[model samples]
Target: MYAVFKRELFSLLNSLMAYITIGVFLLALGLLLWFFPDTSILDYGYAELTGFFSLAPFLFMFLIPAITMRSFAEERREGTYILLATRPLTDWQIILAKYLACLVLVLFSLIPTLIYYYSISELGLPKGNIDTGAVIGSYIGLLLLGSAFTAVGVFASSVTKNQVIAFAISVFICFIVYTGFDAMSQIFALQYLESLLIGLSVNEHYQSISRGVLDTRDLVYFISFVALFLGLTRFVIGGRKW
Candidate 1:
């Protein structure tokens, strides 16, 4: 598992994908937080990063898929799946290693954004009147949300040998899981069903956490969501060998 993790990390860093993913994230961050003029948070209001956090999950819908699309898909495409299957590692080990590698990459891209937080702190009216709790909460939510998306991407990649198809499927799945429940909430006839749908939506939990409210249920929801997809990924890969 450790070897597989290292290899995936090394391969990702050596390729253009790593640079492109980081570059695009930084570009989007810049555009939304700094260069967008009227809508720029820094230009308009307090040191609140509401805009940044608001845009992040949506941006991650694309960026996470880009990073994870080739994890298993490319291996199968290059006929390396047989080699990996023959190794001593179980499917769970392989999936977990790849998932960890992808999570590390996502966190790597996210760490640099702390500079924005620092800059906002320094520029604030009272020298850091910013809501530190909310900022921390938002970052935590972002990490969990990214992890869930990465799991979905890994599962999608495991189901197909074509990277493009993997990317497309991952993006589609991410879109549905992230926002589909919210949409369903609008159409549900029963009030309890509507509430349940809203509760199942990723955006709802994200919003709650981003507001500095760390609900245990929301945290569990994210963890379970990630585990569900990762388990499915392992089952899919194992089934293929059978």
Candidate 2:
């Protein structure tokens, strides 16, 4: 597992892909947080990252898929997947190694955002007046959200040998998981199922946590969601296919 994990991570970091992706993610957020007129913290005159937290999910829906699009597709294309499998690794180990490696890139992108929190907190009139709980909770929510997206991306990649298709499917699935259900619940005909639909949405739980309140239900939902996708990825690779 460790060997696979290290190789996966090294392949990403050793190339320009990881750096470019992280740079793009951070640059987009930085502009929104400080330069964009509508979303700028300076324009709002506030010490809050509500803008960052709000805009991040949309970006992640794309970022994570791009990262995981090659997880299996490249290996299969290069005929190295069989080679890797012959290395005495369980299917779970392989899945998890790739998942963790993909997730680490997301973490790398997020860590640099802490400077935003610190800068915002200090920008307050009296200094350090930001809502620390909300920031902490939102960061936690983002982490879980990233993990869930990574799992989805991994599963999407496993089902196809085409990287572009994997990215499209992953992005679509992530979208549906994040907001499609909640959007669907808005139909006048589906009002009866609104509660259930909202309950299943990442946006709903994510919003709850973004308010600085930790709920065990939200935590469980993310964990279960991630596990479900990871299990699907394992199942896919475990099948007769490559």
For TM-score, the strongest prediction is: 2
After superposition, the stretches of candidate 2 with alpha carbons farther than 4 Å from their true spots are: none
lDDT of 2: 0.92
Per-residue lDDT of 106-204 in model 1, one digit per residue for the tens? 999999999889989999988987899999999999998999999999999999998889989999999988899888878746555888888888889
Please report how far candidate 2 places residue 44 from its true position, in Å.
1.4
Residue pairs in clash, model 2: none
Error of 2 at 56 (Å): 0.6
Residue 5 in model 1: lDDT: 97
Tens digit of per-residue lDDT, candidate 2, span 1-242: 99999999999888687688788988998998898899898998777889999999999998899899999988988899999888888899999999999999889889999999889888898899888888999999999999999999999999988999999999999999999999989999999999999999999999998999999999999999999999998888999345
Give the lowest summed-lDDT range of ten residues in model 1.
183-192
Task: Report the poorest 10 consecutive residues by lDDT, candidate 2.
Answer: 233-242
Sequence-dependent TM-score of model 1: 0.96
lDDT of 1 at 106: 94
